[model samples]
Target chain A: MNEQEAAALFGALSNDDRLRVIRALVRAGPDGLAAGEIAEAIGASPSRASFHLSTLSEAGFVHAERQARSLRYRVDFDRIGALMRFLLEECCAGHPDLRSCCGS
Target chain B: MNEQEAAALFGALSNDDRLRVIRALVRAGPDGLAAGEIAEAIGASPSRASFHLSTLSEAGFVHAERQARSLRYRVDFDRIGALMRFLLEECCAGHPDLRSCCGS
Candidate 1:
């Protein structure tokens, strides 16, 4: 990803609630979780969860699918992978110390 | 790194200028660069670079050391490693796809 994209992705992750939401989705795995289920899991109101999920979706960190009555949110592993690569390779310049942390 | 710390670190990285400063510092390596040098390298004004550097320093991504007449800024590899680990392990929950991106 380019620096601008990286900055925007980081901006999406700059909130505590969003981070919590991402973690919740990660735990939910590929099947994902409905909006209300995510809200209950993260202790956020449905509206607050929806707001953060929308921000994450716009940033390409998460994807939503209409299942029955609500949207099911899932973490986008490929996008997240690209983000980590950008941080480790571009930002860190593949520093050996930082690379080792990634088990590279 | 907890969710709050990760959010704060991502917040520090949310700016384009700050991202440029970080990439410049990574290129500069362990010897680091003074504020004036970093400003020039990133094409930012001295004051602008100083402001972003202060934010990065406060967030523990970079640390400043008094070196003669100026403060030399360097990326904290350990802290950065921790942040990456937080994203890959904690946020991603050690997902195989994400782990592979980290070369784990």
Candidate 2:
């Protein structure tokens, strides 16, 4: 993603419920979790959880699939990695000398 | 930063000008920048830049120093690093197998 896209993605992450919901999906792995499961994990009202998940999906941070009547959400690692790298290249104050600044 | 603190910091980064201003300060290293220099670096109007910098400073992403009429801004790498690590630990969907998810 470019700078503008990164900004938009970060803007989406600015919310507490959204950030919690995304992180919960990240922990759930590629298989993901259904809407109810997400709400349980994040301890939010189902309506609130669904709302946050929608925001994450719209930002391209997560992918949702219909399994039965439930919507399952999975982490979009590609976009997450892209964001990490973009921040490293464009926003990291991380110094090469410090080596602590960049790379995992 | 805790969850709430991380949320707040990310909230500050949600804006384009503020993100640009913070990133510029990150690239500037510990010495930071005067208000005018920051404006020039980001191609923002002085007044606009000052406004953005104030936002950053208030968010604790930057620290300002006054030298005569000029105010210098520095990246609070501690906070930047904190935000990164928090995102990794709290938000990374990364697996140990996919070490790419965290650290850097």
TM-score of every candidate relative to the true structure: 0.96, 0.86
**How accurate locally, in lDDT, is each candidate?**
0.88, 0.74
Candidate 2 Cα errors over 4 Å, as ranges = A97-103, B101-104
Residues A3-76 of candidate 2 have per-residue lDDT tens digits of 57788888878887777787777777778999999999889999998888888888888888999999998987
Candidate 1, residue A41: lDDT: 90
**Tens-digit per-residue lDDT, B19-40, candidate 1:** 8888988888789999999999
How many residue pairs clash in each candidate at the backbone level? Answer: 0, 0
Clashing pairs in 1: none
Worst 10 residues of 2 chain B by lDDT: B93-102
lDDT (Cα, 0-100) at B47 in candidate 1: 91
For candidate 1, write residues A1-104 as lDDT tens digits.
Answer: 78888999999999989988888888887799999999999898889988988999999989989998988888888888888888888888888999887666
Worst-scoring 10-residue span by lDDT in model 1 chain A: A95-104
TM-score of chain B of each: 0.93, 0.80
